[model samples]
Target: MPTREEVIEALEAARKKLLTEDAKKEFKGWNRTIQYYFTDSDEYWHFKVEDGIPGELINTEAEDAEIQFKMKEDTLIGLIDGSINGMRAFTMGKIKVKASLKDISKLQKLV
Candidate 1:
């Protein structure tokens, strides 16, 4: 299994790739926030995308987020690294997402 720092680095790389896409450019204008909680260590990290740039991490629970997703830390790294697909994992009961239907749909585009 990869370490927490490795996972975070991968996620950041993935986020940067997504931000450069034409479809994701609109996200740069929105105040988008995502919270990832590593189930194994029970550590929560929050990310915010603002003004076309990824913001710094914030240590706080995302009580009311536009979208929230849950998955094992290893699984999350795999998904972000293209080793696994989010839909496939979710369909196989390996991942869980909680949010409005619209947000879930939007997540498909984001992730």
Candidate 2:
């Protein structure tokens, strides 16, 4: 298990990685606001993707978030680090996502 700071650092890293041009091109035209809540630490990270890439990352909740996800810190870290598959984790009940079908479908590739 990672400490809270370590998990946050990983998320920051992921946010940077997600903003790269190559990453953005992969999910072009999919714009959405996302909220991630780490259950273990009770921390929230809110961000948005516009025109297919990550926009800004902030340490507060977004009132208009189009998608919300919840999971353990370690699990989130694993997902970001590629140690855990998003689909597998979601199916296994390790993570929970709240969003409309369209948004969820588009977010699949982004994750």
Q: After superposition, how far is residue 49 of candidate 1 from its true place, in Å?
A: 3.1
Q: Give lDDT tens digits, candidate 1, residues 1-108.
A: 779688778667656654666646755565667777667767666777665466776656676655565677888888877899888998997877766786567556
lDDT of 2 by residue, 1-111 (tens): 798688778778766766667677776887888888888878889888887778777898788888898999899888888999989999999999999998777556556
TM-score versus the correct structure, for each prediction: 0.78, 0.80
RMSD of each: 2.4, 2.2
